[model samples]
Target: MLGIFDDLAAGNLAGVTESLARDVIYENPAGEQYAALPDSGVWRGREAVVEAFRRRAQLVDVLELQQRDVVAEGDRALVVTYQRIRHLLTGAEAGYEASALLSLDDEGLVRYWRVLSESAAEADVFDSDLDERLLAAVRAGDSREVGALLRRGADPNHRETATGLTTLQTAAGLGEATVVAALVAAGGDVHSADSRAGGTALHKAVQRGDLRTIRVLVEAGAFVDAVAPTTGHTPLMDALWYKWPDVVAYLLERNAGLGLHTHYGFSLREHFEYELNVNTRGKDKLLVAEQLLQTRTREDERAAGEQRLMAAVTEGDQAAVRGLLASGAAVDERFPVLNGFNDLHTPLLVASRDGHTEIVRLLLDAGADVNATEPTFGAVPLHKAVYNGHADITRILVERPGIDLDFQGATNGYSPLHDALWHGYEECARVLMAAGARTDLVGHDGKTPLDVATESFGAEHPLVRELAALG
Candidate 1:
């Protein structure tokens, strides 16, 4: 019976099926989850049990198999063994202490087998002697020992003791240029992936902005376009995501492609644009990124330009806006894709929303339409200024000639007065009303500004009660 099981483990699926009794049954430890078995959810029957072992064998290259103990009772047998599972592609090894409850038929062939083993997380089959020595040398940056070990037939691509990372990947991640060079020189696979994260040395170098390590890996033939398994992000994408200009340039010079899609379906160009508009940096960084992005294809350049404009507007950087305009940035630039609404924001509306008095004045002086309504929100500069409680800017916009103070948002039908009252901006609300701003404007929900204030503040606060009383 034990010999039959050994034959099965050796990949011979011959006459063992016919020897199993038709009434055989198998049982496993409670709550054990086998990857091959259906969650239905326990193991049962003879053929189904054998199929499970076959599937497990398919995922691993078994280097060695050894049985530790065997106990037999009547027609049943229990066997414990250790199996080494090596990942065929990456050469990673994992071990499992396997226990099988087997029921044999009268003819000496296995009838049913149920395996209760430690879960995958507990499996580690790699030889520790080589791993411990290599990590010690690599971490101490002892190139001599590293070289000697490699020459002595130690695996150069062995992972670190702490992080389960390849020596080259760890060196690059830690910015250890000497160790990286040594490992590369010792025939370490530059394209070797970290055992845990599946990232190559180039990916770590790009992420840490380690220019020296990046160059080393690139020179050693590491794939600059290698993407992380977790993120599906290329090395170039990682650099762009983190705003690492030097890494980006190095990878690009090596022809690292940037058009790869992340797991989130965003390209490297899109990530840069999103960061440019969303990050809290000042105009200088945005401008620098814009200049770098301009070196890309025409479509990417145009997208970056639009993002630059959005950043300038969102951050209220008057100087950046002026400088971009002076450098021939298009004043009427709009986003390429808008689901339904057109993109019609002028610099005035941007400045007014962000409370930038100087930018608003500058855009107005630059002949921007003061009363132009945004296509999505449908609010002019005056409406946004009034709603956001920029009283000084609002006062300037409302008092300007030909600017309408009663403009409403197209989507929500919210007037500037409603917006101010809802957000507890008393001074802006009072100033708008004092300047002949309509107080009775209703939103899409059939509630006026005073009604909103009453509902929110319960008409208890002096200012809220006062606004409600004005109705």
Candidate 2:
């Protein structure tokens, strides 16, 4: 269907003659004011339509063609198109948009076609002053007028002819959220950079501490981490430089990248450090930026300490584990493992399973739960110690004063002693027995510790021998 225009521009009317009915009527707006262009009028029949377009082919040449929309209802269709064309006489190019209303005949050929718009190549598109009008409206904070201008065909990508400040940039710099939203909805380019700074509307929003406007821009798909070409700083780094953690916090929540630095070599934390070192200004507000960064650093450290606590336990580093606990790491955090399931558990649970005896004792002293079960199998730390044959950890756990020595596994219903003997850990079983672990506890298999041990070492198993001697 769009080939109609290409055919028209190329003076090849034969290809489109079949799609046009014998009695088709073509109407368009073109006039004497457009010198050398066809006057606004109507043409009846495919022959008249062919001649009319031939006149245009003689007057202008198409440079680029853009189709906006094509809607059809049954045999009728409407096509909205924008074209950039150069006048043959003046050798001047300009853009024009027109909507073509088309109606198909009984034979599926266009019987009635009309180009609806008063648009002219030179007048409507290069209206040179429309961009200034839109920018001024935004600068004056007139959202209503800004929207009116945009709806009336003001370019959303308008930039200051002098300073390269865009309409969206001006709205964002002024923190006018309504104007920003209106412009963005009108296809404003959020990524347009300030000519001087090479920063985008997002950077302007950050500099003004306008979180509301920032949010609007961000939601409109503004680049969260676009670096300024001049300074090589992102919006987040700009927020940090201004000492506006409130803005920084908002950007971070929007998933802005952390650890971004300036071209001068300073991270977010390093910037805070620089604030303290070369901060000879002695202003109260400057100190406030320092204080905010300090608080941010501490919060990040506390969160990192939680993961470090697990690493210390996993590596069996007793002192690191003790220091982390002393520094207020979570004593019973259920850490996730290989597949990101909450199968791994508290520092004490990890230390116990890995046979880090001193770390186990340290975590227990630091109030780590001695009997917290992992979510995967609901096995407690004592079960992990015995299953892994950490008899020393098992003994330390059994003497913890309130250890659940006979706590059954949620999956298999085995007590710590049953799990011990089932895994052939006679030493772990001995520790449980010395701690007064119940031997009469029945498991899911209807077997006791004596039954499980008899399978391991025949009748000479220690559990079997101990019970027989008691008899």
Candidate 3:
């Protein structure tokens, strides 16, 4: 019995049962008087005793329990305990006294345990009225009274019978950010889901299109991507379904999943697509079909603008390129046909290959990837500039941040310098060499840049002489 108490004091439930016999019996004097108490005051067998203790734990949060008169002689012992416990729901605290009688088995494990505490029966516990009062205060928007009720220990996680929504969910759905914060402060479970649909507080906030409430719930540790079990709808999906573009944008900014599918065969759109002749207003209740379509419209417009920007870049039209870029053209537009400018490469690659140095500068400043490659030869902008003898473009390309100076082409394995030397572009080769391009890196035919240079121009060639000098 002493060992059991010591284990329990150490917050070890497994250790508490170490000294209990398999057939242990437990009796509490107040069990018959308290309907909330388990086992009607008498629990037989070790499992039943443990379950009854667990039920008692739910009813009261024991802060401290000290024991006295712990007399053990032979096979019997009497232990007197004074406990300070807090009511689970009401948060009221009080002190109570109890006495336990235990008999030891042959192995020194407790075979029988009996506790006498009639006052424990009257302790405060789960109250439906208090829960309703908190719910009422929330519904009434009486944040002050709601805070007062929470201070009085109203269970913040109480589930509503009719709606299956927790108190926090209900408050969140009503756009009551202050009330949500108060409930969370009072031990409200931000992750608790509704019993009916398994939607959490954040989902409820999305339904209301209340970013304030959503932020409050999130700040309180609510999961941003918690999916509703019954609907398979994340908070972001819920925001899209409700036609709340502001909420949708906020969720997207927070990195919400865009490629998620619902349980009822509804797939969330990953990117905006233009619908030819159909209305976006949803016919079914599960989705609103509004914000996603609207957002797709904006994306389509931006895509058209980007196509114009690509056309301007291809034509070397500096003014048109500047205007389109200022109006928001993505630095790397991956579209196939851009305003009739058919190309399999990016703006920077086209600009560099065509010797449009100003356009190349614009694209670079607009955040184009310096190492972006073309699909045809798998050659980067540097390869294009050096192979085409664009010495100025080669200089700019090498000077750009994150440029791979020694990157070998995927197809021919020629570094930028090798491509320049293989094409007899001494000026581009000089620019590459001055930028510290490695001369020893080999190409696809197992020939170094120097070997390619010697093959292109004789060893008497000054470029070849420079390569040999570097060696």
Candidate 4:
């Protein structure tokens, strides 16, 4: 039995023929390879079996085969083998554990063999037991329990798959100082941002206005100047946005990056000034404004560089982009646009919308937010690129790491995928789907990207076919 399995695994078809009887019967289940090769099933003779293997070789490549366990009783042996196969044309991989039943004749020659299929694929297997336990401990704020679990081999950086929130982040937001410490000591990732908002545990602490928890996290060495994933709002900006005077002062004292800009192009100092001017609150507002503006003189030195970068980006000048970045301009500098000229004007967004692929790469390399949304309508660079029918730019944005592919714009909650299909950008839609864009994301009008594609192009259209394939 082992010799037969080895012969097949080594591509020794002639050796396999010598082992089998001249009139041996070999059979693969219906639909095993019939979709690609009709003559692959049920071979009557040893020569026919060899022909079936030859046809199968044309369709797929067996990447791996592992013997699991074998049982032998009388003249029969049951052998389990795990096989990983990759399709030649589509490059799709499927792994399954197969049980082969063999009946042997005298002289250790195989007469008949039958292979059974497994119900589950290797890729579909996942063990989330430890993750569930870690989440439960963190959520319950049981520091001792969490510490024990971590020591017992639970992942300190385990994230809730749906929300992408880490255990430390959850504890920080819930003001569980002890749990936060336990997680941090266990090597919890302090830098990972939540998938949805792109904010770190520090941001979560600020959102809850928990100063003690914030102190615990800061002492644990969180990134003080960490920006939100989608909006690029720093901890200081988050404190100001929520009107937490004490938290704002704490962050400012820690030298939180003073000039970081929001997705809407508002700086922390500028946001404070805007709030001061809008409200009638007297002393507190005046004090916060004075403290924040103390660093204005330093920011003024970079003002000229920012202006040049913004001008070059608006014009889609790749050369200017390279020069300005080298001249100390912040990579994600935002400038106020004229009224009715769009709310956000970051270099990346502008270059992407203008279909400047080179400039887009330069800005992304300079740490521009690929998923940063415009403050007015909450559209990211991907949305702008798709709306303008820049298929190349769309492909680049979708391939970027940490890009929110299914983010719904504030305009109508329509994702970039929906925008691409709605505008008839068939190539852009294909690129997005290929990069794992969620086709079932429903917009405000309760329509998926597929629905929009089907409505714009018929069901048989390429766009519809691509989306249907994703399903």
Each prediction's RMSD over C-alphas, in Å, is: 17.7, 17.9, 16.1, 19.7
Global lDDT of model 1: 0.69
At residue 203, candidate 1 shows an lDDT of: 86
**Tens-digit per-residue lDDT, 209-325, candidate 2:** 888899999998897888888877888777866667678777655545455666777765676567657756644555665565455556545654558888888888888988988
Better of 1 and 2 by lDDT: 2
Off by over 4 Å in 2: 1-128, 243-245, 252-258, 272-282, 307-471
- Model 1: per-residue Cα lDDT over 358-457, one tens digit each: 7777666666677878765778777778677898887777777787777778878888888777777778877787888777888999988778778656
lDDT tens per residue, model 3, 1-471: 586776655556677667778999888764223543443477888787777767666666667778867887889988887767666666767776768888989998888988755454334433324687799999999998898678656898999989999999999999998899999989989999999999999999999988899888888877667889898889977776676767777765564655567787766553122221242564332233455445644664575564787778878999998888898977787544222333447888888888899999999998999998765478899998988899999999899888999988888899999999999999999998888999999888999989999999998998899999888
Give lDDT: candidate 1, residue 176. Answer: 73
Error of 1 at 98 (Å): 38
lDDT of 4 by residue, 308-331 (tens): 887787787889889988877877
Model 1 bad stretches (over 4 Å): 1-128, 160-162, 281-287, 298-471
Best by lDDT: 3
lDDT of 3 at 359: 93
Give the poorly placed runs of model 3, Cα more than 4 Å off. 1-306, 337-342
lDDT of 2 at 83: 80
